[model samples]
Target: MDISIHRPESLSGSLREAWHRAADESPGYANPFLSPEFAAGIGGFRGGARVAVLSEGTEAVGFFPYERTSLGVGRAVGLGLSDCQALVHRPGVTWDAQELLRACGLSVFEFDHLVEEQKPFDRYVTGTFASPVVDLKTGEGGYAQWLRGAYPGLARTTLKKERRLGRDLGEVRFVFDERDPAMLRTLMQWKSAQYRRTSRMDRFARPWIVNVVEHLFRVREEHFTGVLSVVYAGDRPVAAHFGPRSRTVFAAWFTAYDPELSYYSPGLIMHLRMAEAAGREGVRVMDLGRGEKEYKDWLKTRELRVGEGFVSRSHPVATAHRLWRRPVRGLRNTVLAHPRLREPADRLLKTVGALRTSGGTGSGRERSGRADPARTGSDRAGPHAR
Candidate 1:
């Protein structure tokens, strides 16, 4: 295998095509987060963004997009923002992680949502988490019939709540692809407040992240399209979600609901509506991403595993990087893995978050989780609903 590194912007058309081809052929790589458009979008803002192209006899066969800090610490591209991470490669191709790192000029490469098929980096993974998905295979009866049969309880409860929402507010309606930019702004604001209220880190507070979301909202592509789905009761927008969709997969990224209407569970209603609409539009999977959440368990057809760890070469910088990062991740994983530990930690963080909110100059932010993949755990809504 021949490895070559280049900035996302500098990549030629051939490289972009190869990147898409790799994603298309790979089983789980069709996620929009792993697409070239997301990489390029992130690359435009993040100067450190780079991709390591793996070639076999002069034909590009793989792409590993990442960002490197001055300290030589590397992370999956849009590490916190992206729900999926991988060295997107064509079938039957593999590379040595250490050599791949050397070619990219990085001492350590860290990732939280690495795809499970990445055997090259499997040894480095400390843990794997469940990433839930909604399988939407439209048939004679279509997605609606599949959902009603699979999640009878959930469907009944959600539909009942939606009906009540309609009665209380107005006639409930949904838009699978909302175009209004104001609705986008409304979602960010609601999400920002949710973050503060829960003591979770507010990602929208970051200027770059804000700009990135806004930029992506306007992008409509074959491999990557920003989807903003909303649920309205008459004229009021009660719930909204913003995420990217590849041709076959719609990643559940940022979702927020109007707290004033929380009594009706608008967020849940929005997701149910989204799944139905997405299926009609040709999306095969709704990637809920990796994290534990009661709602995910209730709604998903099955689970896919995602990994978290650091891939490094045998160097001092690599060792030091791992030493500094692993413990922090370990602490988080421990808390999340156990309900006993997670509860108190959550209370403490909420207390801290409350204090920060009162002060109005909050500095604490979760290191990972771009938008709310789920509203539970830190991201992927642990047990937290809406």
Candidate 2:
């Protein structure tokens, strides 16, 4: 296998076409995050972003999008933001993980939420996690009918809340694909506040992240389109979600709601609305990404397996990187796995975050409009997505 590296934008039209074709041909690579457009979007803001094209003779066969630091440590492109990570390739095209890292001059390549079908890097995976997803299906009366049948209890409860919200707040209505930029800003503000309240890093604090999100909101393509779904009560926006949608799949990304209306369960209402609306729009699957949550359990029809690991080319830099990074991830997973440990950890983070916010010195990144470790590392009000 011949590996050639280029900036995401530097990939020629033919190479991009081939990449898209490869993604389209496999269920594993069909994630919107795997789209070349997404890589280019990341490249536009992240100077380190690059794509490695794998070829046989003169034929392009695979694409690996990643970010390489000057020290030679590499990560999957939009690592924290991308819910799905992989070396997207056509069926039957494979390469050795260490060789691939060596070819790209990467001392180490780290990833989380990697698609389970990535066989080439299978051996490197340290652990696997469940990524919840809704297998959207239409019935006789459409999404509403399908939803009622699939999740009757959830449907009954949420619809009841919607009605109560409407009766108390105003007419509850959902816009499947809202195009208003102001509402997007509102979503961010609410999301940022949610982060602050939870004692998490606010992603919107980073200017580049805001710019990238705004840029993505305008992107409309067959392979990937940025979708912002909103739920409103009268003139007030109750909840909103913004994420990318490929031809067949919609990734559940950033979702937030009016915290004051928390009693109404607007977040749950919003996702249900988005799912129904998305199903109506011809989307077949809604990938909820990784991380565990009760809402995910209630909403998902099935689960996709994803892996997390580090791939290295055997070097001092790789060893150093692993030593520094693996412990952090291990600590995080340990806390998340046990509620007794998790509660205290969360309290400590919240205390730190409270101090940071109060002192006007934060994690330096805005909490909203940015992806979290895998799927926005939080047991969300209702949900969180990257």
Candidate 3:
């Protein structure tokens, strides 16, 4: 019933230990994005980063990480970058959302990927969407053996393509945790090109996000570790993925492949390899994130629900923030929910992308790895790997 707010880096070691214990005790809270380390990483680049600790007597029972604007409007920490958000708490611990807001000195708090078990914030939820996940298990045999048994058809096709890729290139090898910093740069470059080609927001263009990824890459901890997996062919990187992992969960965040090798379905190969390696590394779930995509359907064992909404008090700032942000989110959700509308929107984006590419200063040759029409409706650059 007692709440205290502090800068993420200022949290005592004991408080972080309690936070980790809370994550271990709860199923959904196990995601790396909810970890104190992740919050601190974001806090390093984002000045608004903070954590709200809820306590009963001497024991800290809950942790809520968020970013607040000067206007007192707040949002989940790393909102656009984090795939999971929650008020991680010990079992049976509960607090009022409004009280927590007041304690944090916020007029409103908004989130897009709120955990489903947040009963206190249930009334504030406006919509719930399916977030796909792959439950991984290191079978009696290895990854290949398990894949064949679990998804015979998919394994057959994917494995065959991987073989072809190897034969044409050199050897196809997968690195579960690549340490080279250059590989990280390669991923960002490919992802940037992919964004430009698809006409989506280029997240890598922002220096802070770039810095955040680099900072996280060097972090090796029990609760949050940045994992960069690469699929290489004949010493050439064909596909790569960068995401964060906790003890039990690995979130699928940024993934990109050599566009020239799109015909071989390198992105699919990357996901399958990452899942296998994650299972061996003690990860129980590979969160594919919230989105509708064909690759997700083929790989997911089940789906978890995530909410998007605003929790607010009767303040003009809260009302104004809702009015401005809600409609944009509503339109995006509507487009993503219906394929009939989504297809056209995608086409228009590609068209705009083409125009931009033609007029841009970068040489056409530099963008060679992009412009794959086959990836238009599917998971080309990792946004919606449909």
Candidate 4:
């Protein structure tokens, strides 16, 4: 089989067609983030966003939506924070991962949450993390049953909290599919504020990110839909969650709540409502993406492991680059692995957060609050090929 790569000129028609074909033919193929529309929509900036079509003769067998970067690097579309699979490929294709890298002119391909199905590329990956999920197939009743059977104490606590919240707030209401754009704007503002407070990068501050999120909010498909659920206290919106939803999965992406309603745990209440709504919509899973949050443990029924690693072709430059980055990567990872440093890190973050809260004095806040609007388009005509 001869495998040739096609870097499409435009991601509109041809790219979507290829992605549809691959998705239909592939198992567990319902990842919205892997779709061409998603890549083009969200991966419109920061250079090196491209669609790679792998064909055996004339028929396309695989599609890889990637972003090329410096250090001869290639990353999965929406790499830094995206909680989805990498590379949408057909089931029976036999191609060397290295060959594909060479064909794409990539030195190193970095994936944070690489899927397990890409067997050829598994060898290059390291680091393992668990993604928590709630089974929603049985609807609210089913999940409720599981909750009682699995984490009775947590479920009781949540129910107690819900009651307390209602009692304290007068009346608690949940609105699913809140189509108000104002709500989204509010959520972005709150999320941005939270990011700054935490000394982290605010994704919504980036024009491309903001554009992509807004576009995705309007995108409605069987496999990929953005959900904006709001929890209300009386007539006031207290919490909002903007996440991606598929037929069987509701992926929790971004969420924010009013600090005034912190005593009510509006965020947790919203999540509970989200799970119930997902079950009603025939969604069987609510994926609370990576990271260890107490809420995830409280709501999750099981955990799925996803990995991160780098794949490189036998190019000398690529290998050298990988070797060079290894030590730095190791040091960072080591620091992250230690529990003792958490307090200091938290203190630093709190300090930065305080500064950001105080009214943006440093570069961190500046970088996090503003994103160039002009760079909200795909940059394909560059040395870095997707």
Report lDDT (CA) for all predictions. 0.81, 0.81, 0.85, 0.66
Please report, as a residue range, the 10-residue window in candidate 4 with the lowest summed lDDT: 377-386
Q: Could you estimate the TM-score for every candidate?
A: 0.91, 0.91, 0.93, 0.82
Per-residue lDDT over 1-386 for candidate 1, one digit per residue giving the tens place of the 0 to 100 score: 89988898789989999999988888679999998889988998899999999999989999999999987889999988888899999999979999998888899999988888999999999888888999975644744465576567766766677788888889988999999999999999988887887667678888888888998998998999999999899999988999999999998888887766666767667777788888889999998877776677767999998888999888899999888988988877887789899778767876876676775644333322222222442244342222
Best by TM-score: 3
lDDT at 162, model 2: 73
Q: After superposing candidate 1, which stretches have Cα over 4 Å from the reference? A: 139-147, 351-386
Q: Write the per-residue lDDT of candidate 3 for residues 1-386, one digit (tens) a residue.
A: 88999899788999999999998898879999999999999999999999999999999999999999999999999988888899999999989999999999999999988999999999999999888889998876876797797677679877888899999999999999999999999999888887787688888899999999999999999888999999999999998889999989998888877877887878777888888889988899999888777678888999999998999999999999999999988887888788899889877886777778875533222132323222432233222332
lDDT of 2 by residue, 1-386 (tens): 89999999678999989999999889888889999989998999999999999999999999999999999999999988888899999889878988888888899999987888888788889889888899987666854576688779777766676788899989988898899999999988877876775666678887878988998999998998999889889999988888999999999888877756766767766777777778878999998878766678778889999889999887999999999989988877876777788668766766776675675533333233323221233333221222
Candidate maximizing lDDT:
3
**Residue pairs in candidate 1 whose N, alpha carbon or C atoms collide under 3 angstroms:** 374-380, 374-381, 375-381, 376-381, 376-382, 377-382
Alpha-carbon RMSD to native, per candidate: 4.7, 4.7, 3.5, 7.5
**Number of clashes in every candidate structure?**
6, 7, 3, 1
How does candidate 4 score on lDDT? 0.66
TM-score head-to-head 3 vs 4, winner: 3
- Cα displacement (angstroms), candidate 2, residue 12, comes to 1.8
Candidate 1: Cα lDDT at 261: 67
Q: Can you write out model 4's per-residue Cα lDDT over 1-386, one digit (the tens) per residue?
A: 45444443365465567677778676456656666656666555545776677777777777777777665678777776477766687778767888778767788887766766778887887777776778764523554564565456757765676677667775677788888999999988876766666666667777887877888888787667888999886678877888787656677777777655555555666777777767777777787766554567677889877777788877777777678767765654565555566447645765877866774532222121221111100000001100
**Predicted structure 1, TM vs. truth:** 0.91
